[model samples]
Target: MPTTATPYLLRSNTGKNSLKGALDSLIASHINQLGPSMLVQVEAVTASAASLTGKVTVRPMVQQQDALSRPLPHDIIHNVPYLRIQGGSSALIIDPKPGDIGFIIISGRDHTHAVTTRKPAPPASFRQFSMQDCVYVGGFLNNGPDQFIQATDHGWRIVTPGSVTIEASHIEANCDITTSGDVRAGGISLKQHVHGGVQTGAGASAPPQ
Candidate 1:
């Protein structure tokens, strides 16, 4: 019978070589290619006060690696256009600040070359209704007053957890007004009048005194 090679011999030679080859292939496949489109983190931003367009400097978070598995320094992309989403009644413009992460795609050529960046993630705590185009949150929005509109076990509610005040030049309601609490108004005028705290029907005779 032919002599079989020992397990140690197989591991020392063929097994180690095959493992190395597989690892190299996997790393190569996963490596990021140097190109126009890349995932990047914004290093700094310069917004234009005059227009929605602005410039942003970014560093590539995804980068290619050298043969020895060392990461190579990527070129810092600068003056990339902070683009706005067009074709809507209102444009959605993005102004990226420092530490914001996004993806960028370089387009055009020569003098007209431009880089477009967009933030891929939303704020950590936010609830969006895409169909209604509305958003609700637990925190303050856009330096405005805190107002909570949320759904409860019973139904939906628009609530101000503290004392509430409404100020307007004029307030009008097209439908009938109903309230559970006492309502005090400044000289309320109604098409139908109320006498002695009771609303009387039109053309109805008063009860005997």
Candidate 2:
């Protein structure tokens, strides 16, 4: 009969290794808790022109599991900050809407201290890698947009399927103009309008001085 090795032999697998490996293994056991980055879906968005950043309530796209391997509840996270591309008074705000998917990057420490002040400060709490410390930066789209303003190596293009309204005091154009619709100036239609004393005839007119 062959003698069998006891649980003591298993100790060699971890005990014989370097302390770094052992510590890393211990942390790995709680990998799910160490939030880094995750894909999420935007639930609700709240923003204002007066605020510096927008907040979103999101739901994690990938479900999490508990220690017992049971599926954890998909909770709705609230008061998560979001990113926007802006500088001073020039801002290109791409506000997120419900049903839009996005991503969130989790901070290693508690970061609620800057919520009201909008300035950097020391970590307020000891919580590390919690879901509460995340920022949403919106994500993949399911379809193309009906209206968009895009700039690329080729050129800049603006497309709109609906009407547009512009409020400006003055305007200037340096390029050739083309029009499929009638051009109007001071309530005068160029396509279908007649000047004073002008008749439909082949008569030449003198140049105005």
Candidate 3:
């Protein structure tokens, strides 16, 4: 197991003490140094719905090899940035809970300046591809969600065993509903309770006052 005192690459240098052997070992060790991504188990997450800013505490699921090739646990990383999926007027809010497993992508160089400025900036630190610099992206759970919203090219679908609630100042939808798309609960139509402005269409019921 690689520890703070042991250099991971030098652990397996039992081949020879020659300079050539040393160079070969050094070259081989470089492969493990460039971290593009790593599987991590979420220890905890702190999220702010208002600002949509937060950090994650995670532990690397994969261990580094020591000279003896024994598995060692990585120290739990704290205050790593969380990647929030968002755009101009919309954002997907998915906060990870403890015990959830996910992945963290590593940047080629330090990105503290970029993250702080929310723009492209020079690396603030000399660190390259270090585990200390990672962005958490959740949803790599071993289990699945009971409720899900799926969208396809043809249609959008929301499925859940529990009640689905939509809170808005106004609700409006346009659809071909001669045989479908009516408001219903327990197979009973709630169209009668709905207020007006429904356009007349084939098999469309008149909007009642």
Candidate 4:
């Protein structure tokens, strides 16, 4: 009878002697966690007796997500597991891997974290806000915790865990402004500037009524 496959045996078969050895080595170099086990087959050929063959099935381990719902250990998702990247130069489901960079935005709690070769994972906390490049606002409003905001020279952003009111000029590209209360903005920017709060034409905008 043939011996059952074991974790150690699985590793040895796929590591020491097999084509999967090279693949495993490659994966190890790139990812944080090593995948699960795989099957191994050994065959012996002889004229007097039938060939001796052993079969072992190995399965890859599942990876966990981080606080942002992104890969905990961090890795490029191909076409496996719950998340995967489809064929193409675009970042369909997950973010692009190496050589590609961009911004990541999660709407609210429903929004998910995605992996990108260029940008970091998006925020996941309730009322949490984030921007890739910049943010700008042009209006008046109030803000509080459960509410956060960020603006850069690139563009304007608004994140509200609660609510807020503000006014400004030149909203940036990647902006993160949130409020659980109420938010009112005049001009917002996101890139090199993070400007928020009440602003008037003179620099002191009237506070919320």
Candidate 5:
């Protein structure tokens, strides 16, 4: 009768008097208690239409010390999740790759599991702009140099030190137009034109001699 607060001795599955044996024994004895969440190492990954299946080895916690004399037990658990694949949300598709470490949580008595993949370390080319209340994706240009779109409380905003060019088949606007630069409609007829703070209609003509 081992209480939750009681420290139990771990024994290996092979009955060997080694650290590995002790950790294995500890995991075996507390497998049920280790749920409904456990850290797992992804050995293989298979993608289906809706979900991702991972052949993961569960790392069970044991009351023992590591090789460096650290009081942490690292044990490998085989055949975890019972070959079940967990699907992600429709908005986000999760594709877990091999060697991806993650966690699996048992969600139901019938052994339905929920898996979440951990993010890997970013590469040297990856860049990000982070602030106290704002975050922007930097080092990525769109249409011009030094351009970045930032997410704000109001909405998304594109910032650039240079000019911006937008190409679209059609454009629609529901608000008034304001700009410091000149607005030109290429190869299109104009109904009126404003020059030198004076509006000229299409019916206006040049003076005759």
Candidate 6:
């Protein structure tokens, strides 16, 4: 078994490391036990519901290892810590750490915000922030209906309804299901009931350990 190391803190917008490296670190630092374990989830970029988008799918560079290595089921997942895509012909590369946890990519349409999930949740943390936002620091097991991450008119927000069960949930952060994107639970079971949303199978949803 590999020892779980403390993750390196990420600066907001330094742009030093590629998004891929941040993701790899997230996986390596999480699970230390043997056998199977869920590492991280990634949200990929796609078209919107109202947009009339029609295009041919381009095969990713599977042969190329110099840029980004193909994500594997054994590799731990980590969202790109800091790297923004702007305009045309903009490119960046990231390398992930090696592990058994799977990886997922998340991209936003209008604007993207990476919520820090690696930090420890403060005592009595509760409130709603905005919609379509991402949380990546840690998971909170909230049992209270009023104390959960919620969606508002402006954006998706967090409402800590009550004391949430942090460990029972997957991912470093818990999202408030603000938008219509695919959240690959990897077939994760919830100790609590989800309010509502459509679950899709983009990756392998293995049985939880």
**TM-score of each candidate structure, all chains considered together:** 0.38, 0.75, 0.66, 0.14, 0.28, 0.13
C-alpha lDDT of candidate 2 relative to the true structure: 0.80
Q: Tens digits of per-residue lDDT for model 6 on 107-196?
A: 222123223433444422322221122222211232334444567899776556354344455466475545453333545434432433
Sort all candidates by TM-score, best to worst: 2, 3, 1, 5, 4, 6
What tens-digit string does per-residue lDDT give for candidate 5 at 63-181? 35656877865455444432332345433334444454555544333221222233333322222221111111111121333556778999888787888766699889898977665
C-alpha lDDT score of every prediction, in listed order:
0.53, 0.80, 0.78, 0.34, 0.44, 0.34
Question: What digit string (tens of lDDT, one per residue) describes model 2 on residues 101-172?
Answer: 888898989898976577998888999998898899876763577888999899898889997777699889
Highest TM-score: give the candidate number. 2
Instruction: Please estimate how well model 4 matches the true structure, expressed as its whole-model Cα lDDT.
Output: 0.34
Model 5, which residues run further than 4 Å from truth?
1-146, 187-203, 206-209
Between candidates 1 and 2, which one is better according to TM-score?
2
lDDT of 3 by residue, 1-209 (tens): 75577665566556678655777888888976887687898898788665747888999998977899999898998888887678876777767778888899888898888877879898998999888778888767558777789888988877899886676898776965554556666555766565455666656655544
Compared with the true structure, model 4 gives a TM-score of 0.14
Candidate 1 residue-wise lDDT, 1-209, digit = tens? 99986765245444435865566666775552213455677788887643656667777777768889998877877666655555645654445567666666542222221122234433333322211111111111133335666789997777675876666898887988676655555554343345453455666554322
What's each prediction's clash count? 0, 0, 0, 89, 4, 33
Worst 10 residues of 4 by lDDT: 39-48
Candidate 4's C-alpha runs over 4 A off are 7-9, 13-17, 32-209
